[model samples]
Target: MRRSSSFVLGAVALACAGPDRDAAPASPTSSDATGTSGGSTTVSGSAGTGSATTEAGDTNGATIGDTTGDDGASSSGGAELGVPMFVAQGMVGRTTVSCDDGLTWIGERSWDVEGDAHLCGSTTPVDCSGSGSTCTQRWFDGSCSEEACDCGHSPGFSKGVEHGAGRFVATWGWGWPGAVATSTNGFDWQTTLDGDTFGGLRYGGGRFVVASRTPQTSLDGITWTASQEADFHGDDGVTIWSVRRFGFADVDGGRFVAYASGDTSVDTLISSDGGGSWWRPRSMPSDCLGEGPGAYGDIIAGNGVIVMVDGDGHACRSDDGGSSWTAHTITDSRIASSGVWTGDEFWFWGFGSRYSSADGITWTTTPIDAPDDIGPVARSPEGTLVAVNNVWLGYEQQAFLRSTDGVTWASLPDGDFTPGHPIFFIAFGHAEPSAMCPGT
Candidate 1:
């Protein structure tokens, strides 16, 4: 079942240097991968109230806008239920926080290798399964010393993080081995798959799908099945081999959409039967990749609509389920890194002012105070919007922001997270797996 909020909803640049780039060699096998709107609803107080409701058409529907509450803690008064915590993945590591109401956040776990160093000799990869370690590691030549470290790898860094179909999934990008981390509860994680992987992850139709040079799917996010066709040939006679990079993958209108951009062209692939089969829609326009400095951006699906935008001011939207697309230019030359759907509107944000649209075309600009890139936004089931700025730099005190109405934002305190660590993506997901299945 699709996760929903009573209201309605809704990336990263692939070329920028991830914080881990200095510590680790880029994965030769992986591919580079890599918002807001309306309202002025104010959420007051701290977080973790567990009093927010996400069911649509509630009596409070008429009260969603222009309402003020006592200053106890902020509450969206909506968000997807069963989601007990917030999951964040970035260059520093993966961490979780508990905030039932999406206002006052409390730390849950820092799920990355922080202080501990693992040694695996010159050619061997560091084994991060030891105590105080969880895969994100700096590899050294022959010792566990942090100095003279040659390379490092994290399953999910500045790319490939998605939450859906009952699990939160994160994966490593190019130059590293294919690694995936799955969590039913944000507090704990399991490395479910490794090897022969490229990260363009999406969970839908009762399964998890990864689109790469090869396409693979999993019923439980553990064992993956790869497709037989290694080369993806579009109806236009254009063929892309082993998708080099994924712009973004999302499920909207009960259809799974994955955007793949190679050296020559940009392609949009859609799967109607829960990722069991995929076919290219009419190919996205070439300019959808962007003419700006950063060539890539993100995609979002909701309310029978799918929209994609790149950092260079190009956008594409599909209303009839990816069969055809209409192109539009983002206003003010806005460079978008990420976007989201807020029940009633679509939003795109990046370097400067944020933009929101009721449809995917015309937009309304909202001013913000970020001096650097502001992006990778996510919404809670109860309708809280969380965004991080200075994605590559910035301290936690100034990096995290939350809003119930998307218009007003407040700084969020650091919760068991490294103060200066940069965040890549934020998602709301269940703390427990909804079910289990046998795997290969």
Candidate 2:
């Protein structure tokens, strides 16, 4: 119970993504990582109705010449509550580089074990010992020696990692579900599935898919079952909010077209035979006119054609398989997880313009002057392109930061990313600070 950031707040209950690239591949995200801000006020319409209050992904605090209170203490980190990010500084310390927005910036480190030593979990393989990478839990402090509080650090959302033959996979997420971890040389990693593994673990040709919202399968990523599962409620149930392999990826004949979400509808989930068997959704153009509430992102097949995105920033395209779809322009929206070939042609990211789409349908936006404000978007098979800056209180000290193109950035937070991978949604936020935006 250490109090400083105003009597203390909490986050990082659990995280997942393994396979020894280390951390940052538990993918699948439309974030609200729940930084738990508390007390601040005002939230508007749209985005449902707003009012949910979670703030803290990046809270440098006030800027654009100072907002309401302007100096709670936030130099380059004020906004980013949703998107707008900046972090890059290490060279001799942070290491790992390859910019130009192709991504490949692995940094962000934290220990949090109270500092010295005291978390002998998993029998203490040197602390967290790297089993399936490392994801231990037990923070209680409720008194009478129930103290186990091991903030051994967690938020490892990286945007890089590619281990071929020796094999390694990490597409983040666990507290929100969807997890994947598999390794051969990256480390001893073992756990294979947990939840929300969409958006950044698509191996290609030989094939290996990730985006588990009930749908699970693992021939080699290291043991996983549950071919396809769903239950967003609805029907006589009425819960609605289905989302399975969210977006970006298109192939038509050999088959591998996925972009899911059922209850609210916006479909296209055909796996041909590679992804085992998938084909029970549709609507890319059942007749595009416009619906009520929508949320979709991640499918980006490119050149061969298949672009589909969401958060309303619009980047829809289909060529012929999902029936029909055409609309592309990503200024900003929710774009949670992205990829399409890599560079030059199609590279979309959320949190207001981290874009590139040459053929996906015209787009260029690329402006990520981030001190901290990256909401969604993650890519790194080789094309690089990382801009994940989400930091609340503990990842230890620094917070999250990394930027390749979109305009220079680097925060390090400390330094991490050897095998770590958790690209759940790496865009960025916080632009309103120009005196909150109006003509600043």
Candidate 3:
């Protein structure tokens, strides 16, 4: 959500106040992924009496400050509910304060630092002080070691994929036209495409496919050509269905299955010829509409099964390629925002919880120490699950988390990149020969 000008005014008032400040500090609230506007979050100091109502914004609602009583020791009226910590777009928000058994916000001291929006009281600085042609560090005990990395280049709301043999392709939504970057290792990167904005990027059937109004395909992830035969338009040809989200999976033999969700229409297109051509195989089940929006969900194929899950945890699976689908429940109550298949099991994180399933039919929830509103998770080149979480101070900042088994997670030192815009997607990429450089 756009920051209201009133936030500036509130900041000025708190800055000029006397040493014994009595007024509560104002914190900026965030909107949901759909860009839906909601109510304003109001927090008061002195008694720390504040109330946050559910809004149409991000699934996690708002991020507020710690409410403290007059004595600053005991709790009063501020512990009723919990607020979400901000992440990037489409992901759930986390809570900043430590909670009790009931999950109520109960931190005595305020985690919000005045004037610095990116600085968090709980954030630990990372040490990048090692030497190597390219040294890789690990996230241990909530801090990063002194190794360097080359994966810091900003792609402007980008998504990437590790094609194979250390080759990577990352495409962005806004910035230069056809904005794309390629890397050979997981670290270094170089721009390859500069044409039009792309919606999604995936690799299958011996090529890289980019989803847009008219999808494009490339064998090298550099030069691109439009799939003239691939059709996304409805039967009318005038009602062009917008491709919001899509997923690719390799079925039996070398054949691949691509499931695409439409932005405005309920019709979903399926491709069997490696995204060369698309046809409406079937419509989403009526019961799936309860999962929030029909156009928004994560479609993943792995372990010989293709799974499509909506925002509300409603899931459907296809075993005989994309020809047929069977709807199933996740058993958990929390709504899932994003999910990824880790070659073996399907893992989903949202609303302050993480769940994993090997068959996509039954799920097992795991306990996570991180915030509930964490961003999307992808398998890094090193075979670890990496995810990002945002800390909304005075400014927006990010936190990195890594899990080797997808069950237990650890925090990596914060990356140097502070997003100036909302990041819509992030995937693993390989480093290129020309893009290889010393780690910072």
TM-score of each: 0.65, 0.27, 0.56
Q: Give candidate 1 regions above 4 Å deviation.
A: 1-83, 100-158, 228-253, 289-296, 369-373, 394-398, 413-417, 433-440
**Candidate 2 off by > 4 Å:** 1-244, 248-267, 270-297, 300-316, 319-322, 325-355, 358-423, 427-440
The lDDT, on a scale of 0 to 1, for candidate 2 is: 0.35
Query: What C-alpha lDDT, on a 0 to 100 scale, does residue 246 get in candidate 3?
Result: 64
Which tens-of-lDDT digit does each residue in 1-440 have in candidate 1? Answer: 21111111101232342321221112111111113335321111111112111212111111111111111111334443454556666543345454454554444333233331222222322232122422333322222333221122342333456665456777654433436778766655676765434646655444666776567777777777876343454334566443423432232324556654334333456665545556665434433433321223466655556777555445566676666656565553445346766767776664446666676665566665543345567776557777665444334233566777665666555553344344556666655632221111
Candidate 2: give its CA RMSD in angstroms: 20.6
Candidate 1: 10-residue stretch with minimal lDDT:
2-11
Candidate 3 vs. true structure, TM-score: 0.56
The lDDT for every candidate, in the order shown, is: 0.47, 0.35, 0.41
Query: Which 10-residue window in model 2 sums to the lowest lDDT?
Result: 63-72
**lDDT string, candidate 3, 1-440, tens digits:** 32322233333232212122223222112111211123211111011112211111111112121211111111223322211111122111111111111111121111111211111122322211111223222232223233232112111224433343235566643211325656554333465665455556766555677775577777777777777444444323434333445676655432233333232222355655545565553433433322222122467766777777664455666666655555565533433335676656777664555656677665555556653244555554235555554211112444445566655666543333332222234443322322222122
Q: Is candidate 1 or 3 superior in lDDT?
A: 1
**Which one wins on TM-score?**
1
Deviation (Å) of 171 in candidate 3: 1.7
Q: Any idea what lDDT model 3 has? A: 0.41
Cα lDDT of model 1 overall? Answer: 0.47
Give the candidates in order of TM-score, highest first: 1, 3, 2
lDDT of 3 at 287: 38
